[model samples]
Target: MEAIFALAVGIMAGAGIYLILRPRTFQVIIGLSLLAYAVNLFIFAMGRLRHGAPPVIDPRLGSDPALYTDPLPQALVLTAIVIGFATTALFLVVLLASRGLNGTDHVDGREPEDE
Candidate 1:
């Protein structure tokens, strides 16, 4: 499972980089989203991927590391997801407004034929 998560992170990062280099506003937005997801996954993975583990330590168990899961990474990932979503929506709206004003979706405010 760890290997799978690592592979997924790598794939997302690579695709995000590729998309970010493209010359389109929409691709750049999607690339940013992918990069945000990769970061979220990395942050979550940092807290460990233990299965069937409880979030809090049991007092009677006397601090058994193997029986508990870290809650910090989960909380951080949750916050990141919400922020990423809002930023993505904002970017989309701004992109739409820019397109309407300039009649182009290119980052430099010029049509492909003009370049």
Candidate 2:
């Protein structure tokens, strides 16, 4: 499971970097979203991967770190997911507006001519 998660994170980060380096505006937005997901996974992994562990500590368990998974990473990841979504939407809107004004999907204003 750990290996799988690590592989997923690596794949996402690699793909995100590749897409981010592309010339198209839409690809950059998608890359940003993928990067955000990779980051979220990295942060979540920092809290340690524990199966069947509750994030919230039970009162009866009496504040033992070993008994419960840390909730901080989970909370932060959740918040980041929401922020990433909003930023993706904003990026898409900006991309559309730029495309409309400049008449091209490329990052630069120049449109590629027909071959």
Count of clashing pairs, candidate 2: 0
- Quick one: how many clashes does candidate 1 have? 0
lDDT at 51, model 1? 84
Measured by C-alpha RMSD in angstroms, how accurate is candidate 2?
Answer: 1.8
Off by over 4 Å in 1: 57-65, 112-115
Q: Which candidate has the top score in lDDT?
A: 2
Candidate 1 CA-lDDT value: 0.90
Error of 2 at 72 (Å): 0.4
Cα TM-score of candidate 2: 0.91
How high is each candidate's TM-score? 0.87, 0.91
